[model samples]
Target: MPISPLRAEAPPMRVGLTPVFLDDQVSFLSRWRAWLEKKLERQVIFVQRGSYREIVELLLSGKLDFAWLCGYPYVRYRRQLKLVAVPLWRGRPLYRSYLIVPADDDQSRSLADLRGKVFAYSDPDSNSGYLYPQYLLTMQGENPSLFFARSFFTWAHRKVVEAVGVGLADGGAVDGYVWETLSETHPRLTAATRIIGRSGDLGYPPFVARADIPEAQLHLFRSALLEMATEPMGMELLESMRLDGFITGRPALYDEIARMAVRVGRL
Candidate 1:
């Protein structure tokens, strides 16, 4: 038998993923790292940031090769960042924001009913967790600071659900997809929460890279994601996360969110 040589590793790629949608961070980090490495053929160095603003800054500074960022932040920095891909969740690159209250609380049928109660917001830069809610307040001519007796940012969608479920807050704004997935994966935890309202379809979050990445590499990265749904292993990974596949995104898809942000003074 002839001797075989070993294959060399590809150059490492620096990546950052938001913990916004992840409830089981350890498992998600492991699976995502493995999937990204295999697909991109690069050793990924996963970076951590506490908020979307920080992640955007890291990418803008050229410290991160790419990042998974919320739609709100993506639109905020679209001028400096380029969209690599957007996850198609349930067959569409769209999602919604949800306002949830305790399941047993029948009195609160709508957001207005929950006025004067404490509210939980996930992240300041979050469309589902904060922006959409603020937009709703503005549309209703309600002031968040005064409409709700108090409001706090929980930093994560799961935490927002937890806060509302545990009675720490009267209600919360959360990612509708996260809440639905959590209901299936962690039923007991979310059984106490009932969605009081939901926002219209909004652009899904995206995998973004610096606008200055080499043209060839940028195209390759986008292709890898768009083809993930056809690969058996990639398909499996997407299924586990309740994602349909990846799709190319346009800046116009996020115009509504931007409009909402401007209405709420976030833009």
Candidate 2:
């Protein structure tokens, strides 16, 4: 007798989120998860991790069916991920990088004036924090490594603010949204820093699904997100995350980020 062939099993949908909420406000994430679970009608689990880099790694490894990732990381992994949605900041789908210095420092007014000064970068992989600022510096005919006497990556926007506050570095580029959020909620840090300049706006971070996820399911996820800001439960979650709404997005939205990375040879 011939042996029967076995059928393949479909994998369950798995969603992953960065610790953006946890880092800024954990209470909000808890409420968000509860709301997401009810809205999706599925068991939604929140993966706790140390950094955004780790979240990216987990998603790339097929552990997550979908994820929310920063713009640069999403651009870097666009081949393996599908752009789903991105949040609008201050009524725009894009945000900028802020070159901040001590509130009392009046010596440096322009990028060129920072020559030989110490600088802090949120992270090497950060789009607004590192890449865009570097691009802006290049446009001004300055290389960060050559312009600054020393530089350091603090790995978090708050740390960048803290570093500047304590006079550890002369100044640094921080995500404008993060700066705004911190300034509004955490007055101590923002009080110590002042924005001296702003880089050109770039696409904000996005929600993405793995490339192989079923199209039907992706559509459902998108619909769910699009309605999140309206539902009472979801509205509370959005407020917790300091977001107004989620908007539809395209992969091409992040192409500039990839091009910048390639130009800087950091991709």
Candidate 3:
């Protein structure tokens, strides 16, 4: 009788994430992890943190194998990170920063109109949530620090919307994709706010691996993301996440974000 070969499983890979995407989708993460483990034939552990800074620190310290990071951080630390994939939103690797105000505030048309009002920023390290808005203020000859009556970081995009929705903030900066997605998942929260201004399209947040991670592991995860649109279960997940798919986006895709970072000079 021929002996059956043992199915070898690779060591677990740690993926870091902030609440920017997960929000209340706890079960979704479990299912997603199951899919990835099946694809890689290896254990996959997700490291969830409340803030991007925590995840970034873990990733840079070699504790995390991969992370889905905003364009701002990915560009700022490009040398230490390897771009693996960029999410597709609306069928393209692009999204925008939305400056939002309460639904009843029809008088405010742009960021300029919200001057000296309390503002909520998702995260200081966030592109759409902080850097782009800061750059816009700098370019317009205003100091971001002094432009608002007060400003605070919520550390998560969904929280930014929540802050503005309940009038805890007069205005807020948020990821366009997150806002639109919540419109479907949590319409009442979104209905309480309105997008008063939108930034020029920017690179969607990207999936990245630590530069020193094993090449085989990196390629496997990247391929899994890129191939997500091809299978039924993957497609369902994509739709649930409101993403079209993932692509091997170029570094130039984040040039605009890098420019914003440079202009803000806060990094």
Candidate 4:
């Protein structure tokens, strides 16, 4: 018989992530990494960043092959990134920004009501958490920086909810998907806050690859995500994520976000 040689393991695929949607999901991320490695036949490394700025910086510097990024940042850097896949929520790759306040506060009915109040922002690059709210004020001829008496970065959507829920902030903006997910996973906490306003549907944050990433690696990673709804283990993962599935998303899906960015002069 002819002798066979051992094959070497490929280098790890570095993926960037922030705590925008995933606040403290260590176990789920571990399982997800295993699934991706199995599908791609390559080791995977998940890089955690405290903010989207770190993720975007690493990705742009070629230290990261891919990252899940908010639509606002994605649109701002669209020319430098390639869309990998978009997660489906309630059967669509769309979500909204939620304006929330304490449940007992019935005086607040809209964004205008929250002016001059303390606010919590998930991240400056966050579409639903920061950009949308800024655009809201900008379109109305209001200066966002001056509209709020004070604002702070919670860095995570869940934390934003906690801030408003505990009266730490009079109001806050958050990703509607994260808010909805919390309503399911931690009902008591979500119950403490009430949604006072909702923004127009925007592109769901998307997994993206560096513009120069090899096509083979990009395809494999995208396949691993898009097929998650079909396999048994994948279904379990999807259920835990409270997502429907992933789809090959078009760049145009974020056009509205880009337009909003232009309006806010963030472009």
Whose lDDT is greatest here?
4
Residue 237 CA displacement from its true place in model 4, Å: 0.4
Question: Tens digits of per-residue lDDT for model 1 on 1-267?
Answer: 111232265456676777556735567667766776667776667777777778888899998988888889988888998888888988899999999998878899999998999999998989899999889988999987789999998888898999999899999999988998899888977898999899999998888998888777778778888887988877877777888998888878899999998898878
What lDDT would each prediction earn against the true structure?
A: 0.84, 0.76, 0.88, 0.91
Q: How far is candidate 3 from the true structure (C-alpha RMSD, Å)?
A: 4.3
Return whichever of 3 and 4 wins on TM-score: 4
Candidate 3 stretches greater than 4 Å from native: 1-9
User: Which segments of candidate 2 are over 4 A away from where they belong?
Assistant: 1-14, 19-22
> Evaluated with TM-score, which candidate comes out highest?
4
Instruction: Itemize residue pairs with steric clashes in candidate 3.
Output: 116-149
Better model by TM-score, 1 or 3?
3
Q: Give the local distance difference test score of model 2.
A: 0.76
Clashes of 1: 0
Full-model lDDT, candidate 3? 0.88
Over 1-267, each residue of candidate 2 has an lDDT whose tens digit, in order, gives 111232234234466765332255666656666666566666566665556777787888878878877788888888998888888767777877888988778787866777788999887767877887787777676775788899998878778888988889889888888888887788899889888898666788888888887898788778888898788877766766677888997777788888878877678
Instruction: Rank all candidate structures by their TM-score, best first, as comma-separated numbers.
Output: 4, 3, 1, 2
Across 119-169, the per-residue lDDT of candidate 4 in tens digits comes to: 999999999999999999999899999999999999899999999999999
Cα misplacement distance, residue 132 of candidate 2 (Å): 1.3
